[model samples]
Target: MLRLAWLFVAAWVVPALAAPPDDPLRSPAWPYMAERYFAGQTVRFDAAVRVLMPGAAEDPLAVPVYVDAGALADVREILVFADLNPITTILRYEPGELARPSIGFRFKVQQATPLRAAARTGDGVWHLGGAWLNAGGGGCTTPSQASGSGLWKDRFGEIDARLWPRADGLRRLRLQLIHPMDTGLAGGIPAFYLETLALQDSDGRTLARLQTFEPVAENPLLSFDLRGRGAVSIRGRDTQANRFAGTVAP
Candidate 1:
């Protein structure tokens, strides 16, 4: 009967449509590998479009992210996002009077997965850039010596100014801090670190703010340029609100 034929077609189509494609984040193509190898993985997408650029199987880059600012006339800050690690979002850099429209930094990738960098323009619309990694290592799990105990009890770090000129009177500064920036808990050490750092000038302004973590090396170093010049100061704190302050002379 015609009804029976239609039911058969419906059954076949329904079964086919019910099954979903395998997800690359959790269960990658390399099935022979261990599952923990792909654990804590994440990728970036907007409206279901994956933004990461896939590299050749033989490529050696650990993290790959495309940064494009040609779409906008003015840009604000480039926000980097990665969901696979303990800390999903990586870094955010504020351009702040810099002549360059695009920039990039070398960060340690924690896994073989997708990474994203998005630019927020003056108009407030966010644009995206992304890359993929082929190896796995938890940067957050790395160790630092100064994280805990009474050994560094009074050894807090310091910085001079939040923003200054780059010696050419270009309004740049060298901001410093004193902290162990512990990668994470290992043994008895605490798993504390600075997740973000920023500097604002005399006009109640922000010159630059960096996204930071244990993988950012010890005693984090950040230098940036601002617009105005006059008795500049800096205020920075880690996830624990441990403060690092400094001033620059005009």
Candidate 2:
């Protein structure tokens, strides 16, 4: 009877601790995240959707991630998030006509976590890609660089952004926005960051849009790929309602 009981308990524990079936990355948080975020939605772990990052983060507050879903067709949206972060949602990008299915940005992390990207194609299927990071942790609670000094006031809304023509016939737009991007988790600090940035064509038609959250690092360095050869403009507003705009000629 004792041996039988131990076998029963072992069977239950093994299944409970195992990763969900068909998870290639084998993240321990994938099961909970599946129902919490992608509940009732069709999600697939696809290799064509690539999420690239360094093996270890030198600065937890500025871990860089680059996602390229160019191999997937008719991608409608792409989302990047950390599974175990206090603020999970990092970025939401919709590249309509102005860009390809590739983007790069940096975000903060509280601990070693699974970083994933979900790219939804027009067929109503969501494809996934991700990688795990080895980090030192404590990135979300640190005071921002801008908060450590009054120097942020001198260059709060400055934008160093431009569009460059690539040899592969794709126009790449590289932009950097100067903001503290405080998560407000630190002592006596407030949460502030850029809310939304829109890319528009010469006719003022919105080509793509990116929505960011507090997990993004200070002075966001962003990149996007364009498929057309027309002039485009970037417009955005921060949490304080400060406006920023810049134009790029293709």
The per-model lDDT (C-alpha) reads 0.52, 0.88
Per-residue lDDT for 52-119 in model 1, tens only?
34452232212333344434557677666554555555566666663233433334445655555556
Against the hidden reference, what TM-scores do the models get? 0.56, 0.89
Highest TM-score, which number? Answer: 2
lDDT of 2 by residue, 121-186 (tens): 998888999888888999999999899999888998788888888998888898999899999799
The number of clashing residue pairs in each candidate reads: 9, 0
Superposing all C-alpha atoms, what RMSD in Å does each candidate have to the true structure? Answer: 8.6, 5.4
Error of 1 at 219 (Å): 1.5
What are the runs in model 1 whose C-alpha is more than 4 Å off? 1-72, 94-108, 112-115, 132-138, 148-154, 160-170, 183-188, 209-215
Model 2, runs deviating above 4 Å: 1-21
